[model samples]
Target: MMILSWRRRRGGHRTSKPAFVEDNPGMDLAIPTHFLCPISLDLMKDPVTLSTGITYDRESIEKWIEAGNEICPVTNQVLENFDQIPNHAIRRMIQDWCVENCARGMERIPTPRIPVAPRDVLEICSKIMTATQRGDHKKCMELVEKIKRWGRESERNKKCIIENGSGCVLSALFESFSSISIQEHEYLLGETLSLLIWMFPLGSEGQSKLGTAPSLRCMAWFLKERNISSCQNVILVLKELFSSDEKHVNAFAEIEGVEEDLVKIVKEQTCPKSTKASLMVIFHLISSSTSSEKTISIFLELGLVSLVLEILAGPERSMSEKALRILDSICNWEQGIKKASDNALTMPVLVKKILRVSNLATDFSVSAILKLCKSQEGGDHQQVEALQLGGFHKLLVLLQVGCGEKTKEKVTELLKLLNQQRGRLDCFDSSMDFKYLKRPSL
Candidate 1:
């Protein structure tokens, strides 16, 4: 009754290898072939039967189902049901076989835990919702803690919870906090939002429920909390909500103190992770053309330009890239250009990042400089500053070494602007040495 494992050959089939007993000096033990799973070609630790009347290891079959395959892997037939019924007979036989081969390296396979069913999840969610509706705050929080425990148990359980409408349930939990003072249930709200973040891709309905004015305000309030995890959860949920819908983005923009709060997150949050999230939220906010003016004005008024320049001066590539992207977005407007040029470090940092970080960073840096240099107000002064900041050398090097096509075009244009102002600046010795400054062949 010993179970043998099969090994695949270079050809396309499997061959079984029997375990040999070292204590018996070359005695080969034949294992029952039926106890082996076709998918793994190994001894089935927990055998389960599919709708096709084919049995495979539970782990292998569960993975196949999780991969979105509905057909039986062996029978190639459409599966009527995905439920895996454990084959106790085969499992017991395998256990007995392992015991008989104890003298060898064979070890007994432990019993597998029962999988969580959809009904069980639904029952738990119903209890939580019931408690919530009854204003049983203590009971509701306790149930939520249990749900979080279940979700953290395994990916399978989390997927089951989401599939069973747990996202909507959690969204309702967030909404439930609206009428009640957040201070009373701040910890509960944080836990609920944290769970919702884990169950991402929350449908439009769920997002809409959570995106209500009250919910948005509650999330904003979380940003001002002393708890770092709560703040992180609020930003992450907002990131998803705003990223999915423009309406949510606009709605978020309208929230009082959101801009200042986000900037505060960027400047003061002790967590680097939270700061990065804040930068992304700002990137999304300013990237939208509709909110460009207001977003840019708020960022500049809050000294965002100085903060970004400081980030660029640091060693983190991702942070620098995101900062440059935000700068590029903000600089699309006239006011943004003026603000960037007004900052002393803006031009110098833009030039320093030209060929330094990445292609994306280089493109954004060039675009920001190009925007600033093309403006009519103080455009000439900015061009002169660019040359003095060694921007002329950087652009020349970029063109000579080559860069993205669009970036090359921008550099050519900026170089032309500098060439026109060459006489006003002493940084460029002679225009002849700048002969290569001419537009490159498209």
Candidate 2:
């Protein structure tokens, strides 16, 4: 299976062919690629397109038009709108090549059409990171297997070099340790955050060798320790990270050292369960700072959403409230509101989730969202609807019935804001609030 991950634009955008593909076949392909498809001669996968802009499924595309499409196989430029299919001769040639290369073909051909050296292999792995950061999962999978192979070999070599004392070979691995640490000190966060897309399953091994795997949380600490608070870059990284991986829905996900840090912060007794400080760390990195997609995606990809939901669902009211605020933070990251628009997430669900979280919130906790919903004075209807969907009436009831001055204050603020949209309340008995409701219309 060809894992051809790529970053498509917001809509119908195409990425340029990777530079590795044009150089030598070895760098772009793990196995012999030349014999696969003569044109691009690379791995072929989903949405198999033709010169005429027609897309076929993997099997159908394989059956009808082997050797893949003649044009750039990555985007299916030829089949963009499907005016026509490729010439029969071209399809036949590709079909013949597929038959020859099929794992169960009649003739077993060994040795790749192209031979790959370690350098070429390394280059390919780096490109996988690039593709992943750009939200290109299809392209990332193209080299996954080869990436695993490289890791296994690199692992073996790292052990060998450490044991043999080959001129302190680790130091010469790349120009990084000093630079990596210096980069840490300078507080220069990543703009792309795409590295995390490749760090999964196989891409992380190269951190010691390729310098591609970036430590986002650790880097955040490094920045925080230095008071380097420019957050625009970190947020970009987080958004890109969320755009790629869906693994961040849990609290104790095992992601290198960073996961350990988050867990440590969450579990500490001395630390506020609300995790005000740590939340400040991640929130600053993701919502305020600029980072690569890898960092941004870590929030979404590493079970961060589910984790947030769980935290908001926890028994500790303040902590739960903080978690909901964090969810809102994730939603509000760089162009994140637009992200929610593009993804198929429902506003009602988010509201219901907010209500679920709010039900357990402390006096001031639930009010945070009321303040947020009222931010910018009702210019955004989606936010208002989210609060209402989360059972805004029930929340107001909770605030009303609860016998606390803080609760009253929050309700007062809520009513102040609600008055803006109160005109939509025509069905209500205008005296409803003045009657059975707690604290009486004020």
Candidate 3:
């Protein structure tokens, strides 16, 4: 499937389609960044060619060689024999990607997957911190080293990867804040939060899991030590994670137990713009974690519904699609629509915005809307009625007429769930919901 990407163009009222060799949507034959150097799989660094039926440059190829790395991008075989470059077959592939923005464009398309964990800051640190308390520094060190190794290796990938170990380390560090007295909480939290921030894009997997580690034990430590002040720094890092880009989100996906602290942080402070971004990440990966509902409700109580809605209502496709992803997750199959009624969230109005997006939106935006609608407990007549009152039926009509059988199936299930009031007991079905669709923009 083609993932639509926006590229700035010159002398255009809007973007006209660039000539493509295939059906790849992300395949912008004009963009250079999308292409990988055939040899390193990094940027086509120091691109050059040799004459003897082979090719390579000195500077770029030399570094990977010195670093004890031998895999060649094209062959996937170890380049122990780097005697001559590969053959022209390999060189031709390099030239193609470089000459075009992305060669066949198959290399960079993102395939979505099911995530199994939350990226909680405290939960991660608590894992190792628990080991530290028990004098199992050996275990703690081992866990930390595993995290470090995972991080380094992950970052090396051409595709984004989650950096789980950093959160594990950070979660462990926050555990320290609870060990010390209240006065030390701020310092400790700061030190710990800084370590997470410092780790930044820890080797590029961009996310990891921190599920059910020893992190929860720290909350008791916090209460015992009365170290709530340090919670402020934890909020800051959470805030930073949100405002930071995709890399940060991947790192955060690894955390296991950070929701309550976010509650504590939000309760103590006004909404930081960073919180908005951080919450976006949080909402996406919150899933069925123990703390997911509480965090979702709290963000709602903070009246972030309006803030989140603004993203939903806006038209920057990247942010808009992201807003939908978060919306779909929180609604828990569209549960967020009703969250306003039972929880402190902005369910009703959020539902209205979502309906508007579905009926009037185009392309990926439509998919986002349907996903949220799909997330709703379709078995719940009230949600269907609520969305229908907001003109959701018409939106579904638009989707059926404007989109394909795939989208129609999602819309059909949404309609069915509303009609029968039953959801698929297992996981949400996205096959029915398509992410990319052509639109005349109803």
The 10-residue segment of model 3 with minimum total lDDT is 206-215
> In model 3, what is the error at residue 111, expressed in angstroms?
45
Question: How many steric overlaps does candidate 2 have?
Answer: 60
What global local distance difference test value does model 3 have?
0.43
Q: Candidate 2, residues 201-295: lDDT per residue as tens digits?
A: 22223323222233443344433332323232332333333333323212112334454344344444243522544554455445443444555
How close is every model to the real structure, measured as TM-score? 0.78, 0.28, 0.38
Better of 1 and 2 by TM-score: 1
- lDDT tens string, model 3, 67-110? 88666644456655654333344445545553454334323222
Candidate 2's displacement at residue 214, Å, is 13
| Candidate 3 error regions (>4 Å) | 1-174, 198-273, 281-286, 289-300, 315-318, 333-336, 339-406, 413-442
**CA lDDT of every candidate:** 0.80, 0.41, 0.43
Candidates in descending lDDT order: 1, 3, 2
Q: Count clashes in each candidate, considering only residues at least 3 apart in sequence or on different chains.
A: 1, 60, 36
Off by over 4 Å in 1: 1-35, 43-46, 65-78, 88-111, 117-133, 253-257, 268-272, 287-298, 333-335, 396-409, 426-442
